[model samples]
Target: MPASRTERLLNLLIALLNTKYGLRRSELRETVYRDVSGNDSSFGRMFERDKADLRHFGFDVETVTDLGWSEDDPATTRYRIGKESNRLPEVELSPGEWTVILLASQLWERAALGTAAANALRKLQASSRLTDVELPVGVQPRIKPAGRAFDDLVAAMHAQHPVSFSYLAGSTGKDEQRTVEPWGLGSRFGQWYLAGYDRIRQAPRYFRLSRLTSAVTVLAKENYAPPKHFNIRAELDRLPELPLLTAHVDVRAGRLLGLRQRALAGTEGHTHTPDAGYDRLDVQYRDVEVLAEELASYGPDAMAVAPGELIAAVTRRLRAAADFCAAPVPAIAFHDQPRAGNVRKRTSEDQLKRMLQLVPFLVHNQGLHIQDVAERFGVSREELEEDLQILICSGLPEGYPDDLLDIQWEDDHVYITQDLDLKRPVRFTVEEACALLTGLETLNGLPELAEGGALESVTLKLMAAAGEEGLRAGSLAGPAVGPADRATLDLVRQAVSSRSQLHLVYLSPQGDRVSERDVDPLRLYSLDNTWYFEAYCHSAQGLRNFRLDRVQELQPNGNPATAALEPNEGFPAKLFTPNDDDTIVTVQLTRQGTGLADDYYAERTSELPDGGLLAEIRFGNTAWLPMFVAQHGGSVRILEPRELADQSRAWIEASLASYGG
Candidate 1:
């Protein structure tokens, strides 16, 4: 039978590790390569690729050439993994440290780091020597590094390659092609930024991920090294905020309360068009494009009167939205793909990766309960026994009793007598290091978790253990969501813990008014960078979520919580709870707005030919549909409930007509 890739790699690793003197090409070909059939040239190429793959996994596969040779000769070169270099140094973690790590590893919910974090946690669990302890569940915070650009940049940084993308310059509002050596990606002020050397400008620059107008093209042929000891957060913090520009806008009377709230109190003036039912307001903004997008979302309710660029931008969006909503869409053939089963199927490679760490772990900690080991590895007891069975038969090339790994599980207690040269776990790979380190730093920002100095201590220890490459891999940093909303979160947490009713001065989502209410806090959770508190409100007589940022004041109402309610198990993960009365609306999403399906929890979705999406989503009412369409610019267009689409088109056309479109 032809040997599987997993079996071949394992046998080769064992043969190389067991050799005192490195094995030459011919010797390896006769041994581990015996099952692999190929010509000499093919074998040579395959061996080199395998060696590189091992190196990529942080295994130090060293090549020893003939003595006195100036250059490596393929015939004379021998390869082996040095025991001291390949094995990870023993890491001891306290219970507090372990608990913090567990929390940090769960920080990345949907980002590229999510998978990396899970794998890192598994390896850590295998090697952990600390006693297991449970932690009290609190607000489960998560950071979502959304968008394809984030994934592309992270991959490029891992490979030490440059990236090319067309960036929309915030200052000029023009698209410019940029080649950047992505040194680090971090978030600041609720937005993701890439700090790198701009090859086009021949200088260091920070580019916001949102402004990237095209798909990122990784320049694999080109590579560059980042500055040593670079601190991404520090550099991003050093950047000055953009200068604010004053913009004059007209708001239809009794509409766009959110825009009116930001208006200069004493700067109210007469509208340019008399009897147009408009109120003039002066507003301060940083970027014209950003402000334009916001103003455009109000449709006919708001219009930028001054700043020709702002007017032009808003006009362009309104025109596009009007046309998009009025256009007809072809009938879509909807089909549902079979959902994957809950049970995970373990592949040979997965089994191999686990066993590689499992043997070393068993060696260090002997006679562990079989169930305990199974739980740690997230596998069934039978599956774990299968792993042990396979492991006992795998060993050095020489088929001898003493050459193989000895493992036995009598009385449901497992022990490993021999582990060959794999007495320690392998060092952390780049992705593994990045996931943990970045997660630790992100967790450091939470006010609740930051009270104890354990987070900082763990971070320092991880960085030291990670070494140079690991430290560099931690280039992605999440936005700081704790500081600004710290006070509000502290109060909400206290209320939830005490089961006390609290008085709150909160602004309504529509921004039309502010209301005072006494509520019982149920849970505190976050999405992206915003903090939300789910509670039962006395005024509304039902459950409601209040944004921490929108709270004007919070105080104890001097009453024990009267409402008898329990938070759902999945409350923290869900942003919206559907109601029977909710309207089901269908909309078309452009390529750029496809993320909305996941964000809004679409009921159904179908892919369109032009990389767009046809999504059926539910909304509380049709009142917000026009704003949703305008907010996403032309990326989303209403397609169903024909009346709603007509209303949206009319709303946008009215806005454009005001701008003389």
Candidate 2:
């Protein structure tokens, strides 16, 4: 059921729309009475309030006066809203705007709002002439969140009913049944969390989706009223933090000193065993998951020796990493991942995004250097010119000189002489606004876009343009972006476009040392949830992939950067190089390891009995291979490249020696 106010207002609309001539106050009382009070004065006040609301929503409540029926019947005695005015005006969406809406709608796939998003998309598409811009590739707007637990919680929220589920407590390492009135659901980092009123604690609690063990079931029949001023985001921000615990980790050699500096001081207790070529330090950590990520990233250089949960978490993280590495590559598709061979005809989406952005930008700024515009938009100068060429002949309907946009480009400078009524940026439809709002919230937690300060400004502008509908679009659950990560990415992007060199203090997990180097940056890409930048290092003098998380400090230099290497230039023909120095390690996979094949591309594979797999895998560094192989532990076994097996045993021996076991 809709809100009481909503239901009553809808009824009012229906009653007014149905009555052709007019309805007297007595007749309207019979038509709609669910929200009417028994007192005549109160009912009269309610009717007057309803009339005002209808007018606010653009409905014109007209009065039909009778000369004989005056004095006794007041001005509002016989009232009816005009049949035409009761219906909303048709909403018009530009092709680019429609494309954005379509992409935004896709972000909610398999999520709680999936149905509504789909419905909204279908309606927009039906009203639009947009068949040319539905291709995928460049227009991938997605935040992956799924499972029945998420679905059930969404249902409970919509129904305003209480929900019950079995939650595994990370601190106690135990499971408990919990009843909560779910206030909101969102994703932070790489996990989904539900904020709600907990019956057990009699306070709001946050539950991680991964910790949920049982099916979420609605426990209440009647709808419960939500707090009028309950703020989901504010409530989530108030969740109690876990108490700090000590993580005993063994650091080999002089490695991972950067980790000690980055995490709070004193957390790395000054305890050492110099003779053993390692140190046994007690690092204070509030969260095992975060600590585990740090330890796992160090590969064989660092080992969590104590606090079984921390050790287990490290092992889990490593296993997940190995699984990701072993997973097979997905085949490209037309409406999906773009592959050169499988590429489809270009769509209007990209052109539209560029045009929409450019028109507004040009309208605001009279003239700009062409190069600067290209850099700001993350496009090549040629691409910007091409877009301008298309825009010069583009206008309202046909390509008439006055109807078309008036733009001038001379000597690497461009100016918009006249907008031709395309002055301000296109206003977003309610669906488009909702889509943008949801996308903006989901982007809030991303480390790249989050800290750049650009998204926030864009969000403010979008909100102002979107009005109330955009404000009420609600929140989308997605991995929260970190500010630092976003800042780092933004800095790197600036360095990339300016052709400037960068001084980076990079920590190597395998080398176990913090090294400073100058690099010429290239493009940025994401693997899993982590961001990586492909750049040429002045020290290494080769192309290398740097994970954003491991970049401790970056100071950009003014040295002119080099041109990017062409595709298949100074690199292998395939996506990755298969050099003669590379190790070919073969393994027999247990059922769990078989999934790795699904995640990674295999050079060769053979079937086996008992649903197992025999596969050969390639590796650039066998030293790091041991940690990954050991991560899978018994589930994955090495059958070739005996050196890798030896290395795994060596790391294990070192770990045991550190603990004196």
Best-matching candidate per TM-score: 1
Per-model TM values vs. the true structure: 0.80, 0.48
> Which stretches of model 1 miss by more than 4 angstroms?
1-7, 30-37, 69-72, 129-140, 268-275, 315-424, 443-451, 510-518, 527-529, 537-544, 562-566, 570-572, 576-626, 634-661
Poorest 10 consecutive residues of model 2 by lDDT? 336-345
Error of 2 at 431 (Å): 11
The weakest ten consecutive residues by lDDT in model 1 span 336-345
Per-residue lDDT for 1-661 in model 1, tens only?
Answer: 1226666777778888888779988888987788788899999898887777677656788788888763357677888888777656556788888888877776775566765676677666556675585543345677767465787789898898999998878677778999999989998766689999998899999998867766688999988888886878778778787688889887889876666777888654544652379878889988666788888888777888888888877876787677777677867655643221111124676677777878777876789999998876757898898888777877777568988889999999998888887777777777778888887887777766788877878877777777875767547777775636677788888888999999999877565578999999888777666888888999989788888888888999899999999875452355666566888788898765666776666777777777667877788768878788887667788877888887787777777888888
Instruction: Give one digit per residue, the lDDT tens place, for model 2 in 557-654.
Output: 77878745532232111224445577777766654345444333445665554445666666776766666655544345565666665565565444
Q: Please report the TM-score between candidate 1 and the true structure.
A: 0.80
lDDT of 2: 0.59
